[model samples]
Target: MVSVALAKPLDPCESPAPFSLLVPVYRGDSAHRVRRAIDSNTHEQTRPPAQVVIVRDGPVPQEITDELDRISAASAVPVVRVELEHNAGLTNALNTGLLWCSHDVVARADADDISYPDRFERQLPLIEAGADLVGASMHEIGDDETTPLALRQAPVGRSEIARVAKRRNPISHPSVVFRRSAVEAVGGYEHVPMAEDYWLWARMLHAGADVRNVSEPLVGYRVSAGSYERRGGPRVFLAEMALQWKLRRLGYVGFIQWATNVIVRGGYRFVPLKARETAYRFMVGHRNS
Candidate 1:
């Protein structure tokens, strides 16, 4: 029997995970946000990543390019930039970036997210201990990092993650540090539209990967004004439906479960905007200080 070594309750010791930071940046994203995200990784970090892999997901603004160059030059940690000719979307861009990650573990970061200084140090031991996919909780920052709107917690341990994932996305995408080989073994991220991370987790959980999450909030996820609108609408609903179908096809869910999932999620999306907003607030848990 292959017993997985799970992460112990964290102590003060700084242990960096053997990993590369995977960040995909494009034109539409905030260049300043990208700089701050990388800056967060560079300071107060007890264990910095082996390399920060930046995937240029197409032609970004000249300002973003300059910021990347500036950040790279200033970083004490190694930085690898992979330039793609055209925009391949997040899933494709991530898949492309992973190929260049030399380390076994890969920490994910979005261009707009603000990672806490000790984030990777907290997760490194978990990945080192045998977690194939490890994520941490997050604060959904509204106006600023100091003014967080909600505490979006994730399930702890593999079984908990598996259970929670069956219902909804249990891992905060940006808070995750996962094994590159394990991802590759499961065929990596799919080309799903809005459900890319969810789809990947479903597949990984189904494949029996040892997924876990630390209890601490390691990143502050920025929420835009149009977040709810962008997350709703017919297009998003159809994408969720497609994800369910794919999940069912992967044998992760039975036909009945798939149908139920579609109905449940679809209904949730269609609820009155205010009610949906309330539920989102509820799901995200308590407000952050």
Candidate 2:
């Protein structure tokens, strides 16, 4: 078992160290899943987290709040809950959490995600090694335990990530760990209604930040089947395309590559449910890609 001895309480006014993990939660998510993600890190063998800030967009159920309270009591790591008076969108909630980050490095977590035990243990060293941003491969999980979903790996190295970021988001937002200075230098997370993380990555690259990827699966991204189908529809694709075009206008990459990759990757939508599940199985089990 990994030890949690190094974990410590967070001081709001000053960063105790160089890294803090931030997770933003909307009211409707499954509290159990959120607790799982939080527990994974708090129990891991890691450099003591300066804080694990969970920013809530609005009021949550009593049960969920109680769960948070229980997690706080059981874990040595400080779990700070920041509640908003009203429901704000993801971008605003994330920025709110960012303001509370008291560390030079910031890691992101999603409410429904399950991070591997070594997720931070692996990424933090890379940040200390001087990479401005680092992300790892992700394994997708679904509601049905019998089937898997998509497994993705991003390019490694700052130059490669920069090249990929020009066309598409090479890193998974939930799996990314970045330098607070680099993010703040880029003016923080923009209020893009969609693809906010992609937009921020492009902005960071334009500002000359180094980004890289660890070649290991460090997270299990839950894709609620119904949610995926809805979000992966044409409207979101078009919105993403528009965001990519905005990146092009900024001179990060040409429109052709972005368009081509979008079309090619978009073809995955045509995959039948069973085929998609099969592909995920192969991707998850296959070591080398």
Candidate 3:
């Protein structure tokens, strides 16, 4: 079993309030990747995070625990680990971190994602700008770690974000920073299985929280065929379509609607890869025009 520690409770008058970065770890994750994330926060050129709350689900290997201990010792920032007796999934792990966090701001990081040097620096202002949530663009990095594929940018500003979010998920979860109060107000993370981030955003928006997106890429999101396929492929796509149907009832027409239209118009035979490409080209051309 891994060692666990609950952060000490704090009063409301604490000076230089810190930001809590919640990281959830599961089995099969590379120790080197975890170390890199810790190092990135410690060596941050801008404002470094005050604390990193890592939740290790289930009984991790001894080697991984040791590596975490070593990294925590060398870290300039406070690193706290929470151990669970059994794997309760991402939503539960994040809830553990949320309970342990004592800061006003909460930031999220995934084990596989790499944060740019100025990620925290760039997000701090937006968080202070009275926005409930802020996320930045991400550069999709290939497996070789050197090749960059595409850049994803989320819409910024409350109104623009609402317009775009109505169409699709405009913000990336791993690159998001938001107020703790806003998250709590929305009832925190939900057990949405594969679409946890999307569910959380929908709930937050429903609760009247303002969301924004930064125009700059501040993180590298590793994307692979395997990862994409595991996200439920056709089942996931259909699930999203159902979710969007619900959203439309709430007066939001999502991107899935457009995709579904293309799939239906092009016939199911072309629905797999080629139709997707065609739809992408049409959307890009429309956006540019």
Candidate 4:
């Protein structure tokens, strides 16, 4: 007979570490998905967040606003809403949300994704263990959340993560829980089009931030044919080129690395849709195996 080991239950006497949840929502998000995302992280999780900060990047529809109100009233913990008059884009919205977070440790969640009940139960201890930034692998799922597509794995350990970041993003942004002080110390997130999170991770790595990634999947990331289609096109390729240039100027990557990354990762943005999806699936299978 073969035995499979399971994670032990958290001690009841030892209260979970306190951390704030930051979720930024925009006009395009669905009200139902937003509510589900917040509920999963707050009321449904084994370890609920101390506070939840929902940043309204711009004015959403009345239904979405009402949902936010209901979320605040029904939440077990404090929920703060930071409203911006105009759509300031993701980088601005994220920076704005960071200011309102009350705890030193902040966990990020997307408005459309669902977090596993033990997500924080698995991640918070790493933050308590002195890691400046911690992220986890995620299971890419369809809209229903039942259909699994691929496993996106993040590199583990400080040295390995740093080496990988020189060419590609090493952490899953939505599955991350990072120290507020550490992020602010590196000047917070900057404008990098679709690559803001990657840029921030690169900057943090260059600054010697202690980073780690849980090998197991903790978040259910939503993916679709539309998601794959959006990955390509001239605009996204330009964004990729801009990020590679930024990394080179920051001295985070050597000239050869920068050029190679530009050719490979940047060229990926121009691949045919079917080919791109197949390549992604192949990479996912190769890594998860």
Candidate 5:
């Protein structure tokens, strides 16, 4: 969905709008996946990111170190690695990378997720059209895209995004390209665990950013049926509840919205894995099934 605000003709820019991609990695198991993710961005796109910043969350295994080394050694575009002394989480890693990035626009790539070659190309226009933040739908794949799970959908347009923001995240975290100044204006990313993206989106929206989503799937989001189960637990629920109250304090959530978020999301955390699978399909987004 094009932002209705940008429905008018797209005036060509004097020069290309350059952007950069950022990926955060922790360990060896993710190295191969990270390579594929980077390949999708650089190998065939008409307009690839100017830089790919991979932040080493901590001391990764030698295999991961080797893989990053080899890729950086051969890439045509800059594949810069920022190594951390110890394991800081995703939020910190991203925050670190953001400070190192050069462009005003930044796209995030999960080390384990795959991007379509044109993902960056497709997102630049929305940002150029005054979107501070833009994301798109993704094919939620477990093993492969064939017979996959769901197409994770995000709300489109500013008003719809604000309405959905009161209850849940209206943007896909990994599949986002946001204006650096807009994000920094809202305090960059907080150190919120499990729900950093949710917290950041709410805060950014409250700070009056124009957020929108394209309707098409541009990313292959890796989603095992059991992922919802593993990614949810007592700690995650606690973090989520904390986030609810945080949003409430930020005026992005009301008392009822906060309570409902705590109850509904916390309850979902306790369901069996099979039931969690169904909840993942139902709650995550619109279903083509």
Candidate 6:
């Protein structure tokens, strides 16, 4: 008879499962927010990452680099740094950082966002239970970073996630923790400008990866006035069209769904700045504060 050993159950009291926190910084990112991002994802987490991989997309101000150096030196975990000579944009930068992660599991953090203390503790166990990708709902905060603006919720369960991906991105990127192998197998974040995360989720869902989302909000997504403005504009509209076309070509969506997306999502980009912000808040369930 052949004997095989089953994996031991994870103990809640033990140290967190090993994972690498992946963050990409660019010239436009705020230095102070970056420091807070690094601190929250590491020191404040109930279950902290075993390692951190930060990718400098291009040249940043001396202040940003100095802050990064100071914070990284004080980090509890080992930090892996990668610098690109020129701006390669978010998609490329993320792909480059993905390669340097020391752990099989990687948790993504945006420089402007803040991950809650229980973020990792909540998501890690789902990964252990065979979820290739796990994301959570996020609370969108205003410029103050303390006032809640709205709640961006993600679909839970594999079936719902796959269904939602056919029409829209189901995962919250900043609140995600995914297996590196699963993501790399699907070609590590295809270039889609503003829609890179959506493109990735669609490809991974199509490939039958087990994706899930926690119902509780795990991250504070910073939403400034400029942030809402970026959602519209000509360049963003073109990017939305490109993403829709790519999804259709991949057989992830039919012509009807594609046209609907272009009409709905693409059209949203052409609206006035203030109107777009109002509509967005309504769509995401705006909070009074």
- For model 3, residues 30-95, the per-residue Cα lDDT tens digits are 787777766665566377788888899888777778888897788778888898999998989888
TM-score of 1: 0.91
Among these predicted structures, which one has the highest lDDT? 4
lDDT of 4 by residue, 1-289 (tens): 1111222334657666689999999999999999989988998999989999999999899999999999988888999999999999999999999999998889999999999999999998887767788899898887777765678877787788888888688888999998888888788899998999999888887877778899888999887669878989999999999999999998899999999999888888889999887775554432432
TM-scores for all candidates: the values are 0.91, 0.80, 0.80, 0.92, 0.91, 0.91
> After best superposition, candidate 4 residue 256: deviation in angstroms?
1.0
Candidate 1 at 14: error in angstroms? 14
lDDT of 3: 0.70
Off by over 4 Å in 6: 1-16, 282-289
Clashes of 5: 0
lDDT of 2 by residue, 151-174 (tens): 676577666777666556778898
Cα lDDT over the full model 6: 0.85
Q: How high a TM-score does candidate 6 get?
A: 0.91
Measured by TM-score, how close is model 2 to the native structure? 0.80
2 or 5, greater by lDDT: 5
Worst 10 residues of 6 by lDDT: 1-10
Residue pairs with backbone overlap in model 1: none
Angstrom error of the Cα, residue 247, model 2: value is 0.9
Pairs of residues at least 3 apart in sequence or in different chains that clash in candidate 2? none
**78 in model 3: Cα distance from truth in Å?**
0.9
Q: What is the C-alpha RMSD of each candidate to the true structure, in Å?
A: 3.5, 7.4, 7.1, 6.8, 3.8, 4.4
Q: Count the backbone clashes (under 3 Å) in each candidate.
A: 0, 0, 1, 0, 0, 0
